[model samples]
Target: MSPEDRPAGSGPQAALPGCYRHPGTETGVSCTRCERPICPQCMVTASVGFQCPECVGRGHTGARRATTRFGGVPVADGALVTRLLILANLLVWVLAAYVFTPQLDRVWSLYSVGLHRNGPEGVAEGPDQWYRLLTATFLHVEWWHIGTNMLALLVLGPALEEALGRLRFLGLYLLAGLGGSTLGFLIDGDWLNSRGASGAIFGLIGATVVLQLRTKGPLGPVLALLVFNAIVTYSRRDAIDWRAHLGGLLLGALVAVGLMYAPRERRGLVQGLTVVAALAVEAGMLAIGMGLYGG
Candidate 1:
């Protein structure tokens, strides 16, 4: 109503209406630049998130907060992502194996939502076109790979989704896969042929690891599990792309932290922004890696 009470910063601008992140807090802080009344607790003045104390301590005199209410806690709707991921991969594999029979001299092509390995073009030449980013994650070279990954997904996905809510869970799956693709592209090195959901699967691993840390799970087992997987991926040297796995793991870890720690409403927003950011970072890294390793 009054000038001072006109709500500070873009307070809660990014979050849902009447659904402030922190129900306990009230005085919404506006972004200094935008005059957006953000919840002092859920404020993101710059790129990073901060609380009222930290925000004020940093000497940010830009804007302030307005009155607000916390939103509902997000909920999981089964492992929607896990099933979608599985279906996509299986469909691609079926098409590739059955519908589009491979030939010795020439290659037959089928489209999948996730990335796919082209003959020799590597990723640059590969069919990673827009659809592949989503599809490539579905298909795996071997049934065993899919089975193992799927099992892991079953073990982790539902729980993760429950913790992150269905929406954020979906975001996690997608962003992790994107990160994995980035890793694959950077490491493929003119090889031009790779596929699988390990990137996202690995992302699940990373997320789980973070969850463990957040809940203070025994550090030794979590660290060991990661180490074992990294060792396997790197040493396998067969068809697996450890780089993608690494990227997924790294991205997953970051995403997990963001989801676990960031405000609930911001989960979707953060995940969306993180995915976009991951893509840009992945593309940049891909370019650099191509230059250095393209050989």
Candidate 2:
């Protein structure tokens, strides 16, 4: 509703239901600049009610926000997001073979380290192994595992990368995979083996879910695809790691929160801080666990 239409003296108490953030405070406050609705508590509360916190950044000059052809889509360097991510995964696969190996099992190494925690027959022996989180993501056992994952990565990844950009999209993929691996480790911590790119891929699905929700777009196709894939993964017995998939999904969501929907001003900073904090926490936990748990 336009400001002129509403009664002035109501103190914005009845204004557009405020932000779901502050329940008590009522204020219409059109943010003076950004024009987004903000509650009284969130408002700067200036002469004409208050300005949006975003507006405060420049100290008040009539600057129009840049509008893009696609609202959420990211445009950066010429490199496409999907290609970059696929390349990164491939590089990791190579690294798992030669570079990261202080010792090489050849057969047991892939799917046992960064992206997925399983290799050979069952999940690897070491839970606190530092390289597993990143390395496990790259290794997959079955022919179909890599095939489907790479396909999905190619298809879903491009749109998301276009929306979120190369770096953020890559971050989401890695973080989700790590989360999945971490959960698998935390739950079984012993017998159950873990492996596959499904966990990290699941993260992409999670991010897409949120992106669809935020943009108010149709998720019917995405939902159907995810459901079908999930069923297949479960029926295949030892072919997939459901637990790691779930963990990676949740972690991907947390990472996606900032990348997909953070406020204009807060987006990059919030995501950066979160990634830094999560990596630090993960490192610390692994260090402590290794010291205490033997392997």
Which window of 10 residues has the lowest lDDT sum in candidate 2?
A: 113-122
- Predicted structure 2, TM vs. truth: 0.61
- Taking all chains together, each candidate's TM-score versus the true structure is 0.61, 0.61
Off by over 4 Å in 1: 1-76, 103-122, 125-131, 218-224, 263-272, 289-295
- lDDT, candidate 1, at 66: 26
Q: Per-residue alpha-carbon lDDT of model 1 for 167-232, expressed as tens digits?
A: 667778877887887666666544445567888888988998888777777667657767887888
Write candidate 2's Cα lDDT for 1-295 as tens digits.
7778877766636445555346565555567767777786677876775776766867756774443222243466423767766776666555555665634323333222222333322233454444655666777545466778888887678767767766677777887877777666555444444556778888888888888887888999788877987787689757567777777777777777666666666665776777886566555644443333333
Candidate 2 CA-lDDT value: 0.64
Q: Positional deviation of 155 in candidate 2, in angstroms?
A: 1.4
For lDDT, the strongest prediction is 2
Clashes of each: 32, 16
Model 1 weakest lDDT span, ten residues long = 104-113
Each model's Cα RMSD: 15.7, 16.3
